[model samples]
Target chain A: MEKTIIVNAKSKTYNIEIIDHGLKKLREKVQTVWSPRKVAVITDENVGPLYANQVQRQLNAGGFVVEVLTVPAGESSKSWMNLEKIIQQLAEKHFGRQDGILALGGGVVGDLAGLAASIYLRGIALIQLPTSLLAQVDSSVGGKTAIDLAAGKNLVGTFYQPDLVLIDPTVLLTLKSRCLVEGYGEIVKCAALVGGDFWQLTGQIKSPQAIMRNANALIEASVRFKAQIVAADETETRRRQLLNLGHTLGHAVEQAAGGRLFHGEAVAIGLYQLSRLFEQKKLTAVGVTEQISTRLQAVGLPLSDDELGTTDFYRALKHDKKIKQQQLTMIYLKKIGQPEFYCYPIKQVIGWLQQELSQKKS
Target chain B: MEKTIIVNAKSKTYNIEIIDHGLKKLREKVQTVWSPRKVAVITDENVGPLYANQVQRQLNAGGFVVEVLTVPAGESSKSWMNLEKIIQQLAEKHFGRQDGILALGGGVVGDLAGLAASIYLRGIALIQLPTSLLAQVDSSVGGKTAIDLAAGKNLVGTFYQPDLVLIDPTVLLTLKSRCLVEGYGEIVKCAALVGGDFWQLTGQIKSPQAIMRNANALIEASVRFKAQIVAADETETRRRQLLNLGHTLGHAVEQAAGGRLFHGEAVAIGLYQLSRLFEQKKLTAVGVTEQISTRLQAVGLPLSDDELGTTDFYRALKHDKKIKQQQLTMIYLKKIGQPEFYCYPIKQVIGWLQQELSQKKS
Candidate 1:
């Protein structure tokens, strides 16, 4: 099924083909979609060492001056210094009017590279080749490219639409265990949102090997779930807020952990918390919290909030960019394949956190 | 006079209106153009001290929350660190999607504030109230906003277009002598490029006071000339390149002087150098260079390359952003109101620079 996510807000927005083996029509893709002379492919050390040459060769073969710029892998590299260097290089290389860039790595590379593509020459044609599971499933399609500042993650960035996204399902085979589990958290979020079809498919993905090895089923199910959410609200204005089911607390968990917690592991804990809160509100039935915890743990994710040290959890939550109008908007899982967004006023949310702290002390 | 400057490559663009007593329509002018909740007016110490309060009052009277964000006046503030701080402040202040920003200072404020507007809440509405003469004519109109880095100026920035440009001619009344002359360089460049009825006006204006004293004549002439050139070619692919007449060497002059050389002064010298070169090419004969040089000199401008030290001339020229295919393209003057772009091969341009240097040494 080819469903296109139309970001109708911008002047130039193209269709996003949500299907497996999307990278097969590489040359035709470029000709049909973009009209760029030069393409700077920014990747990470890990992905660059593996697939940089192949991607570069393909782009070069498709008639582009493909320049491979690689940085070391990790969340830390998404810095101002790195962004400035890439901008200078882009200008020095004369990546101008007809020229653009291809972001070829996981989330950090996709983010920083996309940001570079966004600002350089003021919005160039961008193509995403997301190597990591995290990027391919979530970050790549969202049109959100940002670099982190010292204060927190993604403090400095912009929302720039990419010309095309190239997802090679074959690349997921190289992901580590931690990466695989984190990727599945988003996959599970998809399952939880899209209903019986996605939930049944995710339940069938019991074995870690089955989930990791299976590309076609994963891509189809995951892309469909994501395509629906993105199609409805591309800018995250209304209905799109529900897609952040576990991310509110999960993002804070990652921050508190100081980049220690893999995004999926943190999300699992967020799902657990959200489910419990939903149960308290009668939005979810009894045992939903346990189901979420069990499912997440089975998928090799930590479902407990024990990892988030009590002291910095509240501090981290304050910096959450998603909070607008002094409300700590939380998305909760009402049931499997069901999510709901409810604005918990900041005072109440902070009070709940304090209650949790008191219970721990007692 | 009613011509529109179509920003060739980009999606969004608005008109550059240069009218007398623009302050009267300040409310209607901004509201009609951009209906933002909050206008994040980034001013500097100098401009803010003078006009920030008045602008704030005007916007407030129009029922808008005008937050005045002030930074120290200079080029040094245009940095990633400052950008980070501004983003943090905007986020912390709860500047939402409905909110936009008003850039109320000169180039530095416009660049920094416009860049902020481009990124904040994934880009919001931007309005320019450029105070400096350089900013009033140039930066306010073009959507090219950037911050400088150690490597170069405007190294990391975006082409974020503004919704409206509020060029209050009254602001020019308070401008220092040196800065006012700097603005004239842009006017002269605009005059030289679109030489027809307005072309004849350039040679006639004997004093800087001619521009400073009269609002209607100066605004009408400057706006028409620039707007036409911009209308012909917005993104500087061909026709717009003529606007950069003296900038090739002018930017180097500013960098060498450590921000001492006002932008207009550099252009004045750059124009002189270019006019002399045109004379050598038999492009502009009959004492065109002398005529233009004397007027600019009378208005307190450095009109000759002979005065500027020879050191770092080659190095500065190399770093120019307009270089293409290893050639240094220059926008030269053929007459008082006409500019011609010559994509001189780098070797020849360097040869010319050495000749100029030797001539100056003698």
Candidate 2:
């Protein structure tokens, strides 16, 4: 079965296609929007070994010249050094404005390559082929591309939308059990924000395996919800802040953990912790925290890290790009499916986190 | 007296203010659009020593915490190395989305700082304070931000418009005579493309001194013409390509000259040579080449470089970003003001240049 969700962005409108084995139809789908003389398939070490050859062969069969560029599969690959490397390589290969870049890995490759495509010759065609669940449902669909700076993650980037997005759920069967569960972090977060039918569907799915069993439906729901939000607020001026639901604290937790947890794991913990704090303050609906904790724990996703302390989180927050004029805009729940933006003074936010930490220790 | 021309870009509508000694009103102009807590004034070594302190004081008086970031003065400063340095400094300074970047230099600083502002935190407010004639009349008004790569000039960039543009004609008095004359390359090119009254005004101005004497009128006409072209075609899809009147061969000539020639100087030669060739082929109107040559020579601009060779020009043309699918888009004139696009096979373009070079030698 094939499901297509059209995203209307400020610059262009494109489609996100979800299929059982969409990789097989990659060339045909790409040909609809772009017909480049050459295509650079940017993947990472882990994904390159598994699918790069297959993708290259598929594109070649369609009479397209294809070259695969691989970076080491990790968040570290999303750096200025790698970005320059990719751009220089493309320039050396004589990639023109008519050429295209196919980002064929998870979030790291997607972001690094998307950013390269946006600035190379002032932008060329970019098509996203998201293999990981986190990417398929979230990162790949949105046009937000970035490379991390030493100070923080996504500190340098552009909001460059892709020409098309092709998501193949069949690839999930190749992922490790842990990687599959990590994808649920965003799934669960979206479910919480959307509430209603999406929340009920996600809440009922007890394990990663069951979630994978219904990947098509869940992926479509998440992408559709995100697409609508992005269409209305492409630049994230106001309503898009809601999409950063767990990301504010999630980024802090991820930074504090220092490679110990995946981004989705950090986000899972952020969603749970923030809800608990907001619930205690009567800002969030009663039972929302328990509901999120139950859904996350059921899927074996971590809710907290005993190793991270409040000081580490505070340090990370200090460098966050979201903080403006000594205030941070945080997203909280008015109820399941209903999110609100609240501006908090930096000192007050730190105080709240510190008080919550002390109580946990006691 | 201040003359304001508003540019309506796809992302923003900004005012380009032209006034004598406009530096005195820098803070007042900036305050009209942005109220940032901090503003980073990016300039080059040459421009920094002259106007950086003055700009900082102006912005500071408006309660904006201002810091000056200066790069070396030259075309070489527009490189990946400097781009990284500027971005890293902005990140280190904890510059957020609300912060603004005030580019206080010529083309190099404007391009570099504009690119930095476009991607830093996915974009921040950018104010262009173009101090050079090439910048004030051309680069600054159009919002074509770029930095050079090892492979080519402006190989990596973004089409990011600025929040405001301030042009101070008083700065021209401080420029070297050679530097001041170089600015006419683009001014003359715009006149040829927009022939009617603009061409008449530019044609009558016979020297660098005369052009500067009528700087306000000439700059306003050039900016107004460019602003309309950009507003209609922001991304250089079709109509925008006409603006590259002499740029195709101009870039090759500039690259072959290897820093011996200023960008405008190469463009001046490009305007003369291409028109001569096109006029010979009857593609351009009769006497068009002589008209361009007369205007360029009257302003003390070079019509050709004796040092450059056909092979050197061909080598550079091979790397131009405008060439797509082994074809180059060359702009020609139907008459004085009427420009048209003609795509020629790369081989044909090389053949034409080779023929022209041999004739010159003979």
TM-score list, all predictions: 0.80, 0.99
lDDT of each: 0.73, 0.89
Model 2: colliding residue pairs? none
True contacts kept of each: 0.30, 0.95
Q: For model 2, what is the alpha-carbon lDDT of residue A346?
A: 83
lDDT of 1 by residue, A75-175 (tens): 98898778877877886776655577888788999899989888775666788878777787788876788888666777667877787776777667778
* DockQ score for model 1: 0.28
DockQ score of candidate 2?
0.87
lDDT of 2: 0.89
Could you give candidate 1's per-residue lDDT for residues B247-350 as a string of tens digits? 87777766776676777778878777768767877887758777767667767678764335456666667767677556777876656555656787877777
